[model samples]
Target: MNVHLGKTPVGLDGIAAAETVLSHVDGQQGELIIAGARVADLAAASGFEGVTARLWSAATTRSISEAEVRASLGLARQRAFARLPELLAATSGLTIVDGFRAGIAALRPEAGLDDEAAIVGACPVIAGALVQRARGSEPVAPDPDTSHAADTLRMVRGDTPDRGEVAALDTYLVTVSDHGMNASTFAARVVASTQADLFAAITAGYCALTGPLHGGAPEPVLEMLNAIGTRDNIRPWVDAALARGERLMGFGHRIYRVRDPRADVLKSAIERLAGGGADLPFASEVEAYIRTALRQKNPDRVLDTNVEFFTAILLDALRIPRQAFTPIFAVARAAGWTAHAREQQRTGRLIRPSSAYIGPRP
Candidate 1:
């Protein structure tokens, strides 16, 4: 039995692909390419909204205007908001998984029947689950007049989002649009293997993503920066972290040895938001300082920064509230997850990979 699946067989080093544009992850080089260019270069060249259109086209083989996607998402968000009380009420006194279960149970069965509309419809349900959980309040109505990115900002912040802020959020959405078969994507596909609804599969995915090692890392990345306080103490903070055997949360990735492509794209967005006066300098500085220190400490650890750093930074700039970060991730990633789930379902094979038992067994 293989321990790690080693290095992807069949020459497919990354996730399984049904269609491809440019999202490539070279773990050896720590590089990520998006739409025929490096992630960094893509970030520099396009706004997040543009990237969303690009990814959606690649996935669907149909051209969808940003406005169209936004309109659809806005409508979906509105519907999710209307049903929020039920979702939130069911979530009370329940664990995250229980809450997810309750919400999935509450959602109608058609939501997972494999149509574009239903697939898009699940976006807000997944997002609203997280939003309500984070806010400690029931979810609000999603606005149809707003863009998907803008509505997300509005739902979380309880206010209209400025254009620049909306642009930043859209970039975040686009940057994370899809990443091949990540953990959560696989979780979704596994649940779908049972012919479960989109809500069920995505809820399963969200549960997988809720771990600190995954979607939960970004929110804490900000918290870590805040704890570190200032740039002056970055080395001590990181050194102390290493000393204590605490693995740095946002500083590295399982893939991408040089740097995570998404990080560069998001970093560019962060700088733009900062230029528009978002005041995320302290967080940015600490991240930069930490990266430099880590590289110096063990040049061989080859620990370059990854998406979580800028994920925290970008969400912070968008005024998305720390608690909402993971959910926001769920919203954008649901697109990729559903797309992959559909592709997996088409293959008609249960994702029942055999695990090697290492311990005493029957």
Candidate 2:
């Protein structure tokens, strides 16, 4: 086969590999849209189920009601719960996120199963099971009557979540549900383009999100905050880190030259959840100091606070363990992954890209 030699940008930067209506990320404007709805608006007006239904509708090119989506996801959760014993047995001794990946792998997609619902529904259960097992406690089963965000908290804590907690979790889930063709979403589409099952494609997405450069920043953001300890240490620690040419966690983004839009939405969510708590005020102070220090250090570069900064605060306030941060991200992002996978499968063309050879000629 003759390979086409075309000019290719490094990392496929500024490349439009596939056209998608599921989500759009305008880095220049620092905006994100999911299926014609702005992220901020969607996060404010809808829950995870609503946003997920919209994404699914876009991917399948069919209209689906929120009630229908809720029912399907509830059923998926029950199906996944039925396999808990097998999942736990197979994922023994693995880390939380790895356990999630393992559980997904164990679930072979079948013709009768709603692949999208099954993958999205199973992630939270897997994440909750991993958290519980780590605490030497048995996993809690899903409550079909409860909402996804509410049930997730219930499963992990083995108790009912308050209304505020459920709202915060729902906002976080909706905000991070989709963001264009990001690294993990792209990986998912690649797998799906090959006519692979939704489980396989979503597992590929999880593999990509597990990398430190992607969904792994929120935990380290908490670590950085903990190391700072107090407001007085914020400037000194940030200045010292900048002097050493070290990148600050949660301060910068790859695409957004301006502030990340998702950051503001999550910041508001945290503010609502914290509601006069010392942690939120302190986090805000530290964020201000960090922003000032970064601007002073690199006057040209806009190193504003990204989504991970507030994510750390919000998840911490929710009492989610640091180790499970990335897993939670996967739980939220699974909706996007499955939607992109279905869209790619609809295209019916394999995602084949050419590589630029710079080595010795054969």
Q: TM-scores of all models?
A: 0.81, 0.96
Tens digits of per-residue lDDT for model 1, 1-362:
32444444432345353344425667887666654566556556664445555555655556767666555655555566566676566666765434544564465533423243444554555455555566676555676776677767766666777888887887887778677566787788788777876667777787777777778888777778778876788778888887787877788776667777788777777777746544467766776777787878778887777888888878777766665566677767767666556555555467565443446545
Displacement of the residue 40 alpha carbon in candidate 2, Å? 0.7
* Alpha-carbon runs more than 4 Å astray in model 1: 1-23, 33-68, 94-105, 109-116, 119-139, 275-280, 359-362
Q: In model 2, which regions exceed 4 Å deviation?
A: 1-7, 110-113, 275-278
Error of 2 at 212 (Å): 0.3
User: What would the C-alpha RMSD of candidate 2 be, to one decimal place?
Assistant: 2.5
Which TM-score value belongs to model 2?
0.96
List pairs with backbone clashes in candidate 1: 30-256, 30-257, 30-258, 48-171, 112-198
